[model samples]
Target chain A: MFDIVIVGGGGAALVAAIEAATLGKSVLVLSKHYPTQSQTSMAQGGINAALYPPDSCDSHIQDTLKAGVGLAKEAIVQEVCRAAPKAIEWLDSIGMPFSRKGEAIAQRRLGGATYPRACYAQDYTGLKLLHTLYDNAVKLGVALRSRTFLLNIIEEDGVCKGVSVLDMARGKVEQILAKAVILATGGYAKMYGALSTNGFGSFGEGVAAAMRAGAKLSDLEFVQFHPTALKKSSILISEAARGAGARLIDQEGQEIGGELWTRDRLSRAIFEAMEEGREIFLDMRHLGKEFIEKNLPQERKLALLYEGVDPLKEPVPIRPVAHYTMGGIDVDENMQSSIQGLYAVGECTNAKLHGANRLGGNSLLELVVLGKKAAQSAAQMEQAPQQKLFERTKIDTNFIKAVFALPNQIDFWERQEFLSKIMYHNCGIVREEMRLKGVLSVVRQHQKELAFMGVRDKSPLMNKELINFLEYGNMVELAEAVLVGAIQRTESRGAHFRADYPQRDDKKFLAHTMIWKENGVLCADFKPV
Target chain B: MKIKIKRFHPHFEPPSIDMEYEVDNAPTLLDALLQIKRQKDRTLTFDYMCRSGVCGSCAVRVEGKEVLACQHIPKDGEYIEPLSVVDVIRDLSVRLEDALVTLGSSKAYPLDMQKVAMNEEDERLIERQSDCILCSGCLSSCPVYESNEAFLGPFALSRVWRYVADKREQAKKEHIDAVVQNGIWDCTLCGNCTQVCPQGIDPKNDIVMLQSKAVQFGYQNPNLGGFGSFGLEF
Candidate 1:
């Protein structure tokens, strides 16, 4: 029995684990994948922390709340903003090797920021931060469990207990008994077929588990689509493109808008433009080769040195992709979930700081600020005995056999291509009632077929097919949730734009749309953000 | 286009499967696989993502060596297979799960509040090496990885050495000690890793960086003494 059991090994879990360990608690950190192999590692931009002399906590707070579009919890925003500096300082202490300028630090501006306050260790800041926290957590004596899948949560008499996890390497399920549980399992971006900078595991399973355990979800309709993901790859073209003087142009070389326009507006414009056979391009030529080579060298080098298109010489094709989810499991100021002895942070919980849309770099800021908060709160809780254990039935060999025995002769490439096409065409950056409803029907029809499908590989180790099955299941479930939420919401705001309701009707839809699976059906509920 | 794939399993004698794919004007290797998976057959397995080459997902052997499926253009008739001497988890996807896991297991630099300031030269030493995407492209192209599964590989070493070389990080000595295993010492100083890296993060420089730090720490890989020269290209 452990004092604390953490699900998901993103920034939030590592921070919480380290904090709990520092508080002298015997803790365990379980990740579905390896700790650093998370969507957190895919974060190319910097963490937004108000550290520069020109930037202030107040300014950061205001920018965040404004970007959240009236639904952000003001108090929570203040709390996170004030605590953000400490988190950055802590990361620096952990040897993050942040990029600096002269005597002062320099920050590259991103979308929806009032000031240059992003603290970074070059482009892969999150990877660096994850490494730092993971190392610190190990030194402080947290049991780091990798490749462990959470089977289910165990509870008794309405109180939180331990969890059952499948240790993939051992090919067996092990139940971990803990006094408390922290779900830092990240977001549901993988639900969308096309993802910009999202990992294969960002399926929001932790949030799903929370909902299954009766925790209320908030702002489920608030999904943030990044405005500039490469079309074929969905690799995020950082918003720093706009910040660094790149222009969004139509195929005919006309400007879309002031490139610095907010994310929501940019996404809508691009979506509409793509409808008119006007593919979008990020024009970095005007910025000169020096700027491209100096600051944004990766994009340029990848274009010229690798992909064979010099962005300085020509326009690179681009589009919007599902990036972040502003909505998730409802957590309070201390990052405590509705359930006692449970906490969530980072992309897993709804602090409501990023209400409808998240500003660039704030996602990183939230990880540190809310992550520290959850950890600090967990430490203060009176240490209690390990909770009741759930009875573990033997692994269903027949079911496993059936799951592994499905025909691997089916063409997954066509199947996935069809799924992605429908998803991208119907429920993409722009959506309508007719299209979303059609998408729901299509998903319902295909879910069973997908379940029965088998992948070619049966290797006992790193079985990509089995992993894809699980991932596809997650994708289906998350897509269903999104459609339900999108269909239910009558008005458009932030990333959830509806062609049916072209305006933001705050009077009717000020509250958040929360959806949960009840008896195999999606049930919608409302919660104040 | 006719393609031959080398196939081997512990359960069966090693053999090569000859497959055919239709090419439509400048098809990528990924396109050929897509055609094979869709039109021809579906038993063949491979790893891929962000099909346009950014994610470093679809890596496989084109002829005798490794290349990214998404980026490498297919020849009219080519022999392709899983990477050489690695545990092929199905077809193209090797058991790279260990690479990420092993790196995670090695401890990172401890937290220190006071930063060690450095000039531009110190910053430039590591700034370019820090952009690794964990694609394992470098590992796939590595000649040494053929025999030793425990080799830290180019990605991890580059990353580990990135921290070791950073002037801002105070625990350079500790970092040096942590990465000495099949970690920094096993690097052959081959430029193959650098050539294959899609992100242009030369693991060769990073390996050199690690060697310099290892010299500073008075430690050496017994086979290759500290600060020894390997005439590496680029």
Candidate 2:
């Protein structure tokens, strides 16, 4: 059995693999797609670290806490912020050619930063770090198995024995025996469909799988809606644009916020502007074509390729899209889930680093630092007895066949489009009791249709339709969790803004909303902050 | 728009197939491809992830040109084929196992035994070289790889440029040597790879840059003319 099996191949998973491998433990990184394609590579801004002037760990923590709006855990925030500088140093040592100043790596101010602490490698900071870390992990003997999709974790007696993975290449489901399982699967913003800044694989399958294995998820409602996604495809136009002098304008050409507002404020401003029948656009023309072509090349290419707009000559159309999901599998200080030997890090777990909403640069920081902590803790663990007992879940061939042949009445595209419209309009940046309930009712009504969704092609090789159907169903459940949490927390705090209840209520709701399956029905319970 | 994909399974010739259902609003070609799978047939498969172009997973031949499906808009009669010069698995998907093998021989990742640092200004000159997503659009489109399969190809050579341009790397001779072995001289500099790159990365320029770096490193393409004072009077 492998000493550690890491599911997902993003930044956090790579870090965990490296750390685990460093401890003389055999590591396996199972990824749904190639590691380079993971959502971590989509991170355009930069990683946060108080490595330069006007920036300190304490100040960075404070900015993150303020942005989190009362839900950000003090200790966890301290953990990530304290490790930020060292994390940057480690990444640099591993050949992350950070964007530098005179002799030092350059640090710049991102949204919600009190100082210029966000370190970058041009605009593709994540890409630089991800490539280096992936290479280092491979050299360190971390076996990265691509095209392996995790079905579920096999646990018996509160200990994770291993996991069941669908080997896509072999076209068979198989068991992977491991002492520990780490879910580094990223966010579920793609649950919002075309209205999400996430890539296609960002659906939170690991979260759902962990939930099915009796792990509770915390704070699923507070999805961060980034302010500067392209209006057409919801492809992210990075916030770094605003950091480097870009402005948001409503139709008729009036500036909303000129370059330096928090994401929550900007998202609300754009949402309110759109509601007022004003089309939103990101104005970066003043930054000059040379400045853009030099620093923000990724943003320029993304604009020209995806939206067919030139940010240099013309303003790019923009709107808020669901970017990060703060809620995920609940983990402790050690990053261990409720079930023993099961760990989660990165966007897939609620490390409480980003309470209601994450700070601009802290997302990448938390992934690296907390991911390392989890690896060290797991590596230090006394090996659990290799018990023969397992909660074996037999594959029901009849049910599998029945699911394929189900009389799917509703088309998946129409259903997804309808859901995206409902979520984008109703449960989006601004939330209300009536709107959340409306979407919940719609989901409830379509439950049967979802169950009966059928696949026409019977060829089993590379059944993307089956994967889509499964993920779409999970998205519905995960979306329901969001609506449920939104309904539960009747307060405006961080990203969870309720129009009906316009004030932050710390007395009754200054806690993380934990949601899980209780008796096959969704149940929400609050845990004190 | 009727989407046509030349479907191929292992050990069989590709079959022509058109999608059944019509999608109302597909923001990109990827969305349309997904709709074809979801609304029509579950078994019709292709390799895709990160509908965003950054992932490089959804690269395919669209109307005889290599492009990222996620970035391009779908046109009617779109003929989806496995990106050329890669092993075909099934349908539009290609077995990418051997796709990036040339990168290792090119020493794409720095071969530094010790950690090194370079100034940000120095890195800025070659930073664009790092953005090659290895979508293999360049490799698939390159006439060098199409003819001489052993050629180091476009993306890998571009990566060598990314490293050779780096002032931090003390020892880059291995990278230069690897490129020469893989026939750095084999590239035609036709610019097909540059046209096909979704990220706007210029592999042709990078390859030429590597050639310059190779000359600076006391190596010259063996395919070039007589070294004996034939063209130059010293």
Candidate 3:
């Protein structure tokens, strides 16, 4: 048995693996795809670090707490902000190739920050950071198994024993016993599907599996809507574009203002405008072609390819789409979850860091700092003896066979598409009591209908259909929790905006939303901060 | 639009075949492939994650030229197939884990670099090399790796150059030594890797830069010899 098994291939898993390996512990990293292909690579903006002059960690923490709308844990905010410079140093030491100023790392102003504190490598910040981490992990001899899908976290008697996975390359069900398992499998913003600015693999399966294994999830309702995704494709146009002086314009060629506002406020304004039968556009033509080509090349490429509108020549059509999710498996300051020997970091865990909404550029920073923290914490624990127990989990070899043997009464793809549409309309940027209730019922119905959904392709090797089917099941399961959390919280706050309530009711709903399963039934409640 | 997919299934009857489908409202090749998988066929397999060019998982060959499936708008009756130089896992998905191992073997990252300040000019010198997405499109078009698998391909070589040019990296001599064998000198300067790089990273130029550095480090091309020494007795 390995000392630590990381269940995702993103930046968090790599950092954790490197840390664990440095601690001289046996570690294995499991990924559904190549390690470099994680959602972390798609982060175009930057990572926050208060290393520039006139910027202090106190200002960064205050900005983060303000963006979080009173739900951010003060202690966690301070810790992350204080650790930002050291994290940047470690990343630089490993050759992150961060864009440099005059003998210092280049800092840019992301939307929610008072100072230019976000260190970047132009617009390809995430890609460069992920590659650097992956290179370091490889150099440190971290064992990585690609094409391994995590089916379930094996928990026996309230302790995480191991994980059950489907080896996609070998076409077999395997159980990997581990002393500790770290979940870094990203967020479920893609539950909005075509209306999401997430990668296709961000289905929150790791969070769902953790919840099934008795991990308590917090704040599953706070889904951040990016203000400037391409209108037709929902592909993200980074906030860095606006930071570079691009303006948000209405169809009548008037500036809509709030270009530098935090994501929630800006997204709500754009949503309100779009609801009134008006279109919004991101005007980057004023930034000039050379500047666009030099700094925001990815944004230009995305706008041209997805929407066929060149940002250098014309205003790019844009809208707010589901971008980041602040809710996930709840973890303490040590990055340990409710289950013993089970830990979570990065986008998969709600560490009370980005409470109601995430500040721009903080996600990447959290991935680095907390990823190393989880590994260090997990390494100090006593090694659990290797056990032959794999039959306690809900999914196993027989479970896969049964799922494949089920009658195909419903088309999962159609149902998934239908669910995405309804979720995007009802439970999306704007919500109310009736629409949320409607979507909750639909989610409950879909959960019940999951039994009849079967994979048509019974091929064992590299069966993407089976993987998609499992992702759909996980999405349906998590959608129930999101809807229930949204319906229960009567007050509008942060990204969980309730149109019916219309105002922040911090008096009653200042606590966090907690969701878990009790005896195969989903349950929800609130935890006071 | 009508598109032809070169299909391959190890467990199927014939193992390989060309299938055509007419898909509506499919703007990109990825959309058309997903449409076929959702509506027409259930067994079609391809790999994609971000559906943008960043993740680099959706690179395939269209009409025998490597391109990212999500970024390339398809023409009518165009052919889509797996990358030519890699092992096909299924229909249009190629195995890249083996190719990625070279990133580690080539010592593509900085080693033992002292913490030093860097300027924007030094950062910009290696900026284009750092933009490589590791898409393997370069490897697929690389003529050197097509015949000799031991040759470090374009992406890996470009990454080596990324560190060798960085001011913060102190182990430039070790990096230059690592690429002297199958890494830099093995490349034929064919320019195919530069032609197919979606991110516009010129690995050929990076290889030339590495050659210059290698010579400065007193390592000559092993294939070269003194004058009048072309296997003739003096």
Candidate 4:
């Protein structure tokens, strides 16, 4: 039995593990795959912190609240902002090679920052930070159990117990008795098929597990779709590109002006252009060939050296992809969920800071800041008695096999491609009531089709079959929650723009959307932001 | 155009199967596979991303070695299939995700940047290697990875070297000691990582630097050392 069992490995889990170890708690990190594979490694932009002289906690809070379009909780935003600086200092203390502007830490301007307050270690800031944090945490003796997927959270008598983790390497399920648990399993953006830049493991297992364990997931409807992901591949081009003066242009090379415009506006514009038979490219031309050659030389190299395109001369095709999810496991200002001794952080939880749309550098910032808070709180909580309990879940091999044998085994890819097209056409960027309802109906049909998915390989250890099966489940739930939330919200704010509503209606829908799973059915509730 | 793809699976005969594809001028090699899946054989599978190549997905063996299918231009008579050695997922998409496992497993010195003041040169040296996108390209190209599954591949080791070389990062000795085990020592100092690197990061040079740092940390490659030597514990 351990003091804490942290499920999922990402920026939040890594930070929480570090903090827990610092506070002298015996902790185990259960990562479904290797720790760094999480979307945190994919983070290209710098972390947000009010380190610049002109920047203050108040200003940061105000910006976040305004971007959130008034749905952001005042206290949570304030707490995250106050904690932001300390998180930066901690990262700095632990050798985050933040760019320096003559003895002072150099800062870059991202979408939401009023001033240049983004501390970066070049473009691969998240990767560097994650590597640093993982190294530090391991050295401090955080027990990292890689290739361990949590089957379910074990709760007893209304209190949180340990968890049942499937030893993915050995193909055996085991119950880990622990005093507390933290879920940092990342967002559900991948549910939209091709729209997501999320890794396959990013299918919202933790959120589903938490919901299964009677934990309410808040703001499930407010998924933030990033305005730019590379076309076809859906790889995220950091908004830092826009922050560095990249523009949004149409097929005729007409500038949209507000390249750094809120993601909702940009995504809407891009989607509209596509609808009007125009291909959109996040124009990196303005950032200058020299800057692209020097700072983002690899991006140019990736284009020419790999794609054989002279990016300095030609425009790279681009599109808006489902980037980050703003809503997740509901947590308070302290990163504590309603369930005591359980905390959620990073993209896995809705801390109410990014109510609707996330600021550019703020995701990583929230990871370090509120992640530390969650860790500290979990560390301080009284250790519960060990409980030997394992939740029962059976894998139907026959069903899995039958699905694999279906004539349309590989057709799922084509279906997924179709799903992406539909999503981008209907539910993406700008949504209307008619389009949204049509999207839900299509989503249901897709979900039904996915139900017949079969696994070719039935192996228990590190089987892609099982993993894909799990991802399919996550997609179904995520699509339902997003559709429900998008349908229910009935307003325009931040990333959730409804053409039917047409305008930002602060009066009717300034609340958080909470989702719960009961009897295999999804249910929704609202909380005042 | 008639395209030949060399397919390999543990279950298949002769280790590699050469399959032919007919195509038109187009999107990508992956686009060709989708065409084949739609028209000829549905079993043909390969990994891809960003049809543009920024995501580092869709890497596969074209003629002899690993190449990102999205980036590698389609030719009239090209050989395409999954990368060699690693577990095959389907056709061209091998399960090479283990390339990043060492990043989480390695030990490094404490990150007390407040204590260490960095010079511009040191920062430049560290920045040069930190851009690895975790594509399994280097691993697919490495001969060492072909023989030894336990070997920490180029990407992870190069990244470890990236941190160890950083002036601000503490635990330089610790990082050196960390990678010298199953990490850097397992690398045969081949230039494959440098060659296949889409980002142009040289894991060979990074490994050499890591080796130098390991020496500074009073550690030696136990496998390479002639005399009985002791391993340093941080």
Candidate 5:
């Protein structure tokens, strides 16, 4: 058994593996695909660090709290913001190759920041950081098992016992026992499907598995919609482009200002405009070719490739797409979930850092700081002997077989597409009691239909259809939770805007929406911040 | 659009075959592939994550030219197949295990680097090299690695140069030594890797720079003979 098993291959998981290995613990990273091909690579903007003079951590913390709209935990916010500089230093020591201002790391202004505090490496910030972390993990001899899908977290008698995974390459289910397991499995914004700027695997399966293993999840209704994704394809044109002076314009060529506001506000503004039947475009033509080439090269490439519009020559059509989920498995300051020895970090966990909404550039920072923190905490815990296998395993196996044996009467793709459309329309950026209930009923219908779903390809080796079907199951489960949370939280705050209420009701709904399973039935409650 | 896909399964009959389908409303190769998998045959296996070009999971050869399936718009009757350089796991999903191993063996990351101040010029010098997405498109087009598996291909060599040119790195000599054998010298400078790189990283030029650095360190090309034209031994 390994000391720590990380169940994702993104920036958070790699950093955790490096930290655990540095602590001289046996660690293994299980990835559904190669480590580098993760959602973290899609984070093109920079990571936040208050390194520039006169921009203290206090300002950064205040900015973050303001962006979170009164729901961010002060303690966690302070811890993450205060640790930002040292985190950037650690990254630099490992050769992150950050874009440099003379003799120092370059800092840029991201939205929702009080200062130019984000240290970047051109526009490929996340990609470069992820590669550097992967390189360090390899150099430190971290064992990696790619093509392994996390089926469930093994919990016996309310204690963590590692995980059960499907060996995609070998086509079999196997259980791995670890002293501790960290879930760094990323966000679930892709539940919005074609309307989201997330990878295909961002289905929140890890969060679902953790919840099944008796973990509490929180604030799942707070999904941040980025203001400027390429309209044709939901591929994100990084906020760095706007930070570099790209303007948002309406179809009449009139500037719709608030280009540098926090993501929620800008997205709502654009959503309101689009509701009025106006098309929005990101105008970067004034930024000049040299500046675009040097700083925002990836933005230019994405705009040209995806939408067939060169930002240098013309305005690129854009819309607000679901970008980041601010809600996930609820964890304490130590990054431990409700289950013992079950830890979570990164976008997959709602550590109360980004309560209602996440500030720009903070996600990458959280991946490093909290990733290392979770690893250190897990390593220092006393080793627990292996417990007997739980009966839940047998039940889960039967369930899997039942799913495979069901008739293929309903096409999984069609159902998935229909679910995405309804979610985007009824449960997306704007929501109300009637529409949310409408979508929730549809989601419940889909859950009922899951019993009739099956894949035509019985051969399990690298079965993409099987994976899609399973992901659909997970998505349906999470969709119910999201709609329930959205329906329950009757006040408008941060990303969860309620058109019915139309105001932040801090009096009654200031607390977080907590969801968990009790006796195999989903339940929701409120936890005071 | 009509597209043909090369299908293979180790446990299936005949092992390999070409299947064609007419995909409507499919704009990109990835869309067409997914359409076929969803509507025509559920058994078609491939891999993709971020339909955006950032994640490198969707790289395959379309009409014998390596392109990211998500980014490349397909022409009518174009052929899609797995990358020729790697072992196919099933159909279009090539095994990246061997290529990742070559990357690990290169030791391309910064070694024994001190925390030092860096300027914009220094950072810009290595910026292009660091943009590599590790897509293996370079290895797919690399002529030298086609024959010699031991050769450290374009992806790893470019990463090696990324660190060697950085101002913060202190162990440049060690990095040079790491690439001297089967690494930089094995490259043919054929420029195929440069042509196929979607990110525009020029590994061929980076290999030439490594050669110059080696010459500065008083190391001769092992391919060169010891005897001079003047018969200096007399």
Candidate 6:
């Protein structure tokens, strides 16, 4: 048994691990992949900190609250904002190579930011911060377990005690006992399928596993669609392009709204334009070759490799794609979920800072500040002996060989693509009641298909199919939850847009929509911000 | 394009088999493998994430050349294999645990810094060096590492150089001394590691920089110390 077992290796996990280790707690970090290979490493834009002149954390909070569209909890926003500068300092202390101006760290104006407050290390801000934290976590002497697939959180009488994991490489299953377990397991944006900005492992497994353990989930309907992902491939083109003077052009090649617009507004505009068949283009060519080369090199390289367009020569074709999940397992400011001895942080938690839609660069900021807060609170909790031993029956080879020849491979993939298309069309940037109903119907059927088909792969060594199968199952559940919550919420607010009821309804729909599995159905409820 | 992947298993005869598959319209070799796995074979194994190429998880040897499968398009009749000089976990997926463990061996990070302020030029020098994704591509490709396993490899040496270049690193001597096996002088500087880097980090040059610093700290490869300076003696 360990003192603490963190279930993910992104920014949240490392920050928490470092804090716990410093407090003399034995720490174990189990990552599904290499810690640095997380989605946090994919964050291209800078992190937000009001460190420059004429800018303040309060103003940062104001921008975040505005972008969240009346859903941002004032207290949570204030707390995170207050901790933002210290988060930057923490990152620097760990050797984050931040790009600096004369005396202070440099800041660039992001989409929703009132001032130039995003501190960066060129374009690879997330990579810089994540790697630094990773090094620090390693230095803190925390034990790391990689390529371990988290099966579920073990709870006895509503207290999380440990986690069951499938060791992918060695082809074994193990029950790791712990006093406290932190689920920094990211979000379900990949449930939006291939068109999402998240990596392959960002399945809402943490939240889902907790939900299965009788934990309630909050705001499942709020999925933020990024305004600019490559046209052919949905790989993200960071909004920093706009900060560096990139423009969003309509099909007519005329500049409409570019990077200056807030994420929600920009996503909506892009979706509308895309619906009108006016393809959106991120025109960074006018920003000049020098600026694009110096700062936006990664963006340029991705454009050339993935989308086959040079941002320096022409406007790269882009459209709105599902990116961030604003809703997740509800947690307090201490980052403790409803379950005792269980914790959630990073994008997996509904920390209530980004209530409906997250601001640009704020996710990375929350990753550190909230991650540290969770560790501080978790470190004080008394360690209790397990009431029940959480154990897997066995790693059976028969279970891996369950896939049937009846469902052809092409047919299986087509179904997945179809389901993704449904999510993209109905529960996307713009939503309609009829479309959402159609989506939910198909989604529920897929969920049944997913459960009934216990289809799997035989080999246990690096069994990616088994991982994908589990992820698909989680995605199906999360997709249903997303649609169910979307269907229940009748008003347009933040990313939960309703075509039929195209108005922000504070009278009835101001609160959050929480859902949890009960009996055989997912039941929905509400909680005030 | 025809893709041939080398398969490996412990109990199996010959311990490896070359399996071929047909692919079409795939943007990269990683995409082709994904297609084959999803539709062709269910049990095929490999490591990958963020297939857009930054994660460096999907690295493999295509046509005997080290490349990120997410960035390389499979050519006609391409033979892909696991990264050489590393023990295989299964097939293309190999054990990088040792190489990855060495990433922290030099204490490359600023362990004792109090978040002190620094100028842009101070950071700009070590900027290119900090871009390592720890894919171990350089380690797997290097001739020196292939010959001498104790060489600390290019990534580790470059990591040490990243700290040595940093003004914030107070314990620079500990970091310099950590790269021991005459590590700085052992490098052949053949440019193989630099050529193989997906992120274009010049580890070869960084190794040379570390070598220069090591000599300044009165260290040299004992293997080469036998040869005296002929020109000065003459």
Q: In terms of TM-score, which candidate is strongest?
A: 3
Compare the candidates by lDDT and give the number of the best one: 3
lDDT order, best first, reads 3, 5, 6, 2, 4, 1
lDDT of 1 by residue, A13-56 (tens): 88888878877887889987666667777676788878876789
Model 5: residue B5 alpha-carbon error in angstroms: 1.5
Better of 1 and 5 by DockQ: 5
Candidate 6 is scored at a TM of 0.96
Alpha-carbon lDDT, every model: 0.71, 0.81, 0.90, 0.72, 0.88, 0.82
TM-score of chain B of 6: 0.91
The candidates score, on chain A by TM-score, as follows: 0.92, 0.97, 0.99, 0.92, 0.98, 0.95
Clashes of 2: 0
The window of 10 residues in a row where model 6 chain A has the poorest summed lDDT is A392-401
Per-residue lDDT tens digits of candidate 6, residues A241-355? 8877788887687776644877878888888877887888888888898998889888898889888889889999998898999999988777899889899999998988998
Error of 1 at A407 (Å): 8.1
List TM-score per model, in order: 0.84, 0.92, 0.98, 0.84, 0.97, 0.96
lDDT of 2 at B26: 75
Better of 4 and 6 by TM-score: 6
What TM-score would you report for chain A in candidate 3? 0.99
Clash count per candidate: 2, 0, 0, 9, 0, 1
The regions of model 6 sitting more than 4 angstroms off are: A391-412, B114-117, B227-234
The model with the greatest DockQ is 3
Comparing 4 and 6 on DockQ, the stronger one: 6
* Model 5 lDDT on a 0 to 1 scale: 0.88
lDDT-superior candidate, 2 or 3: 3
lDDT of 2 by residue, A435-490 (tens): 89999988776665776666665555666666676677777778888889989899
What is the TM-score of candidate 3? 0.98
Candidates ranked by TM-score, best first? 3, 5, 6, 2, 1, 4
Q: Between 2 and 5, whose lDDT is larger?
A: 5
User: In angstroms, how far off is B94's CA in candidate 2?
Assistant: 1.5
